[model samples]
Target: MPTLRQQLFRIKPVPRQKEDVETDLKRTIGLFSLTMVGVGSTIGTGIFFILSESVPVAGPAVIWSFVIAGAVAGLAVICYAELAGSVPVSGSSYSYAYATLGELPAMGVAACLLLEYGVAGAAVAVGWSQYVNQLLFNLFGFQIPHALAYAPEEGGIVNLPAILLLAMCCFLLVRGTGESIVVNAIMVCLKIGVLIFFICVGVTGWDSNNFADFAPFGISGVVAGSGLIFFSYVGMDAVATAGDETKNPKKTMPRALIAALIIVTSVYVLVAVAALSAQPWEKFDGQTAGLSAILENIVGSQWPGTVVAAGAVISIFSVTLVSIYGQSRILFTMAGDGMMPKLFREVNPRTLTPVKGTIVVSAVIAVLAGFIPLNFLAEMTSIGTLVAFVVVSLAVIILRVREPNLERGFKVPFYPVLPVVSIIGCFWIISSLQIITIVVFIIWTAFILGLYFIFGRKSSVLGKQLAEAGPTNPESARTDSTGGAK
Candidate 1:
């Protein structure tokens, strides 16, 4: 038997088979559909409501926060592209770390991914609830009561609309990925137009005075704000998580990742700039339906607010759907590796999707959305995503050194320097997060590692395969196209 340390340090083999032909997941996602997954998952949560959370911390300098967060996310996704090309599997950075770093590190990445996708889904659902209320009030002149629409911490009994939104997303995800992607694509286009409408009308109210106190909180505040706003960029990596379901993923994944990044970042900065110019940064705090409220303030009418709120209602549904989809798929990958329960990996024959896992993921996310405060959820998501991005950047370097001839369809520009910067940038933002958030993250990761020692390490399919092949030639056991033991 191999030593405990050796088992922990074992890396998964880089897949060399045809991704399209050898996977259980249907390869129906093209570049456009995949890019929409990223966009649909991202745009809904942040630009629509994050200003209320971030602008308070960085003041009008939240503009810089958006740019900083996007820049770091850009670098990380570039490295992610290379790894997705090399590993060509589901599970995003978790699988990348397994292929390059080791089993233990992969588990750590899994903990981070759970937070990145699952928590983010809940966080966005909470934002969707706020917009739902706005839409209801706009059109019907009534809204869900505070006790049912806001979290307990936010002075409400529970967030009903958020839970309802998550339930709707769960139903769609259980149906199929292809169907979900098409619906998400249509929503993406509509929301983009709605955001553009907000921008055009918002510019009309630009006072220029909002710039006078841009950096009220200085560098520390900017960094902290980036941490909160980083939650907005979480969905970009959902592209990589779809590797198993993407057609020609090697070429398609990178293109989709980059395209999604460009579109999301551009829309984010424009929305931030337009939002700040229209109102003083201080007014953003406590604004539940942020964009719609801002537009109503600027136009002095209900129609513009109603329009934006309606668009947000439509668009955020797609965000919740994609977030649940990504979370369930990551768990599916983990279960296939024997790192999680078997139910997560079981696919329904009729739907061709992991129905059980999707339902479970939705249940957990519903509880989170219904109870947790959005700011706390958002920060936790940012911290988790930052750690995952750091791992992906490091994995890029490790893979380059370990498998110099690996067949990668995409490569990071500037090589080691870019990935190194990505690592540093991610850590920088992580450092600025609230101490409590950091403490919670450490506790969560340790808990996951504990589970590994008690369960995953013993039941790992890779460990069994390695034992069968003998420690002297562990590489011979090999993993399948799905990153499970072959």
Candidate 2:
């Protein structure tokens, strides 16, 4: 066994030579498609369902929560922008960690991403189920049975709609990345258009009286709500996941990351303000499809609500697809790095995509969607993203010192200050999470890390590099198609 210091901080950073990066993925996605991926991924289940949860916690001050969450997300995305400029790969934060932190730290990052994307996919699927039921009811005056529409804890046997949505995404992914991302971009535009519609209609009912006692629960409530809404911003990092497949990554990466972050934050803030102005915050409690509920209550008609529900059905479905795509690709990258099973890394020669990996991810996400409550899964995703953000932020600092002369198409403005603030922001957001959530995240992380020590550590591609190359030095190994330095 290696010494504690060696195990903790061993540097197995990948060589930055172009030939060293093994990739079969096509550089197809342009900046617009990439930006849409971030927007589509970020503006999903959180906005659809979390509003109902956050309003009860922070009342009208939930608008501030959106701003807080956006600021933190922006900080993290800036750090990711700088790193993505330097390391163009598919693993997002996991790839960044491997290239700068080392094998052990990379494993930790892989575990967090798996947890993050997996649960996020499931959470988004669950939210889709709600909107599906809402649309069905609005269209036909009847809805799916409670037992088939919710988790067991919610008095349901299984969430069939969520499972079906996962299956649809799996099919889309197996078709190819080019097709899926284009479809995802189209759906993103539709959703944003609908959100704009909601804001326009909702504002018509705005009364200044609703703003009274905006922060009834005080600063603590705003802070707590920020933690919940942070999940809404979790998927912006999905943009960085496209580095390997993006056209002109160094240029496209930073632009898409910033564009998506700004667009999404603006939408969330606008929607929150409109919704708060529509009615007293107390009315938001116990509301499902919160935005639609607000619209319906104001218009005194079901047509507006029906339109919103229909829009949600489309939007959340796209989100589930995009999120599941991100999850599958991350696992594929890990498998290539030898951190996971080879089955996940295998890309279909016909489609030039990881069909098996996509199926595996969809199946797992389907199970979680069918059984777990959205609330639990959303919390797990937020925690996982928070953990990954901190790692990526730290990696920015590490890479700057280790590779001072590295070419960076997009340098993070403000240098160390931005990255440092990003780290602090992540910790602050995490501090507001429920103690139970923090405990569960700790236990889940330990379980993943434990598996690494037992099996992954010895089997990883980096471990083979250490065995064959004699020593683990910066120049000793080269990264292969499988993402391991050998």
Predicted candidate 2 versus true structure: per-residue lDDT over 1-486, tens digit per residue? 456556545555644645234576767789999999999988876677778889999999999999988998899999989888888778899888877887677778877888888888888789888888778888888989999999998889999999999998899889999999989999999989989999999899989999988899999999889888887888888987877788877778888999999999999999999998998888888887788788888888899888888778888888888888888888888787676889988878888888988998899989999999987887677878888999999998988998889888688888899899989999988887789988887787788778777876767776566556665553565665356554
lDDT of 1 by residue, 83-132 (tens): 87777788999999888889999999999989888888898899888888
TM-score to true structure, per model: 0.94, 0.93
Off by over 4 Å in 2: 1-9, 18-22, 212-214, 471-476, 480-486
- The candidate that achieves the highest lDDT relative to the unseen native structure: 1
Task: Report, for every candidate in turn, its global Cα lDDT versus the true structure.
Answer: 0.88, 0.83
User: What local lDDT score does residue 421 receive in model 2, on the 0 to 100 scale?
Assistant: 93
Count steric clashes of candidate 2. Answer: 1
